[model samples]
Target: MYGVQINDDGTIEQMNDELAQACVNGLKNLEIHNYPQPINMEVSLLSIFCGFYGTSNETISAEGIGNIRKFNKLSANADKNYGQASSNGERKPNPWILTKILRYHNKDHYEQIIKPLLKKNYEGKKKEKQIQINQTLILNKIDLTDDFTQLDMQEKAANGEYEKEEQIVMDLTRILIYYEGETEDIYAIKGYDAICDTQVLYHKLEGTVYKQLEKININFKNKKIDEKDNSKPITVKHIFKKYASKFFKKRCKFISEDPKILTVFQGYKYKKLHTIDYECLQMYFYLIKETIAAGDERVYEYILNWIAWLIQNPGKNRELQQYYKVDKVQVKIDSLM
Candidate 1:
């Protein structure tokens, strides 16, 4: 009855229709203002065009492709984050990281934090060259011995890759200052970052615990007491299995009280969602961590089982949950996915 109310009748036609509507609505409500520049709009539109006209087919307009190239050049020239083309005529910027920074962070934030960081990175190349020049001068003056070679390596290792600590502090302080702008300002942004960091740490720890649980080889099926040698320390897997089973058993009692959860299993088989939209997963993980510390392996099992169960049920509006509206990460889940 709940499923019908939600129009999730397990019909392929309904699913396809809903998807089509979503796509149309997405295109109709498209906003280019959020991008670093209008050139990014051309890049995005080009991508969409290419996707519509498959790679094998050259049905896409050449003008659209040219626009992509034009914008890319303009974008690079406009943003100092991307360095000038090298002698080899290749773009030397870490495009992946740069794009991610541009996409998620605001223009003001980017100018304050990312711009300086990018400048520092670009300066690092100059420092490396300077170090090399210095090394060559020393080598020319000194004898060609193994000791000198060792010294050269040490000098290069010490000074070749240097970070501007002052610049870093300035960038980070910009964020703190921005948050401290409002009257009666509490450092809420740092607290938010701390919470996010905790979630990320817990997520990673939970993933490790799951992998260990899955690869568990020790048997405890019919044992009443400890059978392993006492002299040897308890293995992580052994401890994990012991506590996880305990927590699973404890959690099983809750299902009886709330029988609705049991119905979730009747709908579909468990399968990983083929989408990069995991904002809900992060939220669920945080809830699990809050309920129980992730240091305890049982908590990992609890979260993993919950995720597995959620992925199986089509009745749940999992897609809707996938998008997280946060100040730091305003991701367009549909486009990104």
Candidate 2:
């Protein structure tokens, strides 16, 4: 499924053109159903998988796919072994080692080449390594979790979960700071469980969309609290501000300022942020805000939580459409070929 060639020497080859073209064709054909018009777009499986997994790493290039193919069997075995090890709280066959093997594609040399090298590097310096990690988290204002205290962070980092959490924390901090002008205490809102509460709130509000509820009021102060300390409550109102019209416009302007960022959004058309797109997105913010401002507490909570979740986890947009059983925004092309 990973699109790449595995060489006999355990080197990974870039994706072949024919397969890429075929996959693009498939997605482009689906444009009539729910994709945007002018269905000419390049789709990257590596990008898709990374997004699906909530990974921020763009380093999973086509070559990485080949690297993964080499020891698909070994990875499965490692995963099974890792599961058992984790349940028993033993740290044998660290997932990071498996990850290194996959990325470098050196199954044969892992014992002779990789293990010994890593052992030499990390054997006597465990506490020092952990201290550095703890210091980095402190600098970022991310809470030092039990995972960080233990070896769980390193293990989860191998699979990108820990990295994903850090990015999410950073994004949340930025959102809070953008609205409140400082992340004085928001740094306490760290880790997956904390973020998952917002994710779950998103799903709950999504379900309420089908129901015609004109009432919505949300006491944000009560629902979400800093997991690290129940004493410090995170101001969830700042999260709602993230989806405010001003924020969307500012974000659009900021994103448009960078050529590379624009390229990612504009795609084949190479167009700048169009007035229509901006207005539509702004209108979405307005409608959502109006609903929450006028509706019941539960509705406000769900919408705000969903908005917060979207800010950090953007890959779920496609899945959101599926959950709602609807196509993405359908704009009239107003042209006939």
Candidate 3:
């Protein structure tokens, strides 16, 4: 399972369950439903509270009910990046991306509960916002949060590596970073996908990838993935389908694999992925560059199918086969489905 991490001065920490429970009453008081229900709920709210790179000083999110607010009206750069570092100075750890769980982010949960909880706790506590967040209830948010883990296990009744892997299967672009703390490091904690091409990267895990995990020695509490929320399996595939449908202004009945994309990636090898005619690149860029329209007729269909193929075969390079942690991701994806 993937636990929510709080990087305090470069040291990693997980969300405190006691703190989450402590705020249950506060969230309920605000008429917020499903507070602290999801696995990453705490972190998700906290990340949103950090503000969107100080982009707007607005109090709330549009189109949602709870209206998740910006606790700090005048947010600084410090307010952004959550606990992530400032720049790429040296090699540091980066977390893997997970399938976003925005199931409960609508009005009642996000706005009423999460937004108010953060604003209420963070007003006078900016000086020790991290402390307030770590110790107090407030909230935790985890937008595109990257991480590293030395996860390996083949036991029953308990699992972590597999949960992280399953997230990558759905998430696709996420990759593992090898860091040796005081010496070696890898940057790009947030938005690692932005730096890479399409996902369809890993269909297998690297054997010594565990060696890299051993190097970083990521030590965080155990947090399992929430397979089913309200009897429905939580999924990001549906989320992607939703956006793709809206983007092309058509119903994405079912996304299928695009053989052309994979045929081009056969035997391709690289540590870092580079864009080469859909050979390797990100779906965001792939779709945006062409900017297909509903009126594009069958072109719209082809674009959606291509995205579906990317989801199935996302790989950065030969390194991705080793980096995507296929074993870890596959187990989780299998269990969830």
Candidate 4:
């Protein structure tokens, strides 16, 4: 006696009995059957089972068995292609397979996989269709307006909701560079202004416009005094006090605001300036571009300073900085200015 379960697609789901016995040497000797959980047996019976249950009078034959063997071979090849096969040519459990199994074994898991994939596929297809439906939207838009506003471009982009093809990515890069410039204005402005303002505040609090010059002298005196008598110069306390007052004033200003946006902005500025280098500015631009592309608008003041930093540093970091050299920086600044 043999039993099988098959999907509507004629794919094997499970098998049992004489065929299983032949494949695993003897069904009775198999330890899997006595276990609490059901065991899977590989056999050609699933297609046979589907054929038997169907309205057709077709019977399973030698050719049907051969077809099952072909399916198994093709499945093995697919598994191998996905690196889900062991060196011994046995298929190993993988996320893709496990996902399928979980879908079959549990309703929640089934919904989890089906819902997301179905939603994503449907949304992608829907957007593609909408683009065709509104085929002349961009053309009509350009005809109506002499200059394309950000809002207009955004609406087109939303309707054009086509997946970003590689060529489109290049085109987008060119367009973004042509009008908007390579670097982001908000990021450059915020970063540049924050650093400058902080420096200015430090100078004002210190009662000296030449704090850096005074610090250099104090550093020299400390070095010389240490060399002579191993006594550190007392100028250290004066320098520390001057800077500490500025630090406290900044902190007081920061804390004076409502805890949400002000706190976040201060922290963001601090992190941005802590490592104010070419790489940092480049990364900041990347994030800004992504945010804008995603239609998010949360501008911060530090963006200006970020641009200035990019202009100043260009690419002196250990890693490659050719893309952010002085020429590039100057071009970026010119765009924002």
What are the TM-scores, per candidate, against the unseen true structure? 0.16, 0.15, 0.17, 0.17
TM-score of 2: 0.15
Model 1 Cα lDDT, one tens digit per residue, 1-337: 0011111242211212222222222232222221233433333332233222222223222332333334434343423322222211122211222223243433454455444554454455546654554344311111111122222322432442213222222222221111122233222111112322221101123444445334423332222232233224323244333323112211111123352111112222233457866886788667555434333445456446656666674344344323333334433333311
Q: After superposition, how far is residue 159 of candidate 4 from its true place, in Å?
A: 1.3
As a whole number from 0 to 100, the lDDT of residue 173 in candidate 4 is 20
Whole-model lDDT per candidate: 0.30, 0.30, 0.29, 0.29
After the best TM-score superposition of candidate 1, give how far the Cα of residue 182 lies from its true spot, in angstroms: 59
In model 4, the worst 10-residue window by lDDT is: 26-35
Can you write out model 2's per-residue Cα lDDT over 229-249, one digit (the tens) per residue?
433422223323322222111
Q: After superposition, how far is residue 216 of candidate 3 from its true place, in Å?
A: 29
Candidate 4 backbone clash number: 20
Give the CA lDDT, 0 to 100, for residue 241 in model 2: 38
Please give the lDDT score at residue 18 for candidate 3: 30
Error of 3 at 308 (Å): 35
Model 4: CA > 4 A from native? 1-99, 106-149, 165-168, 178-337
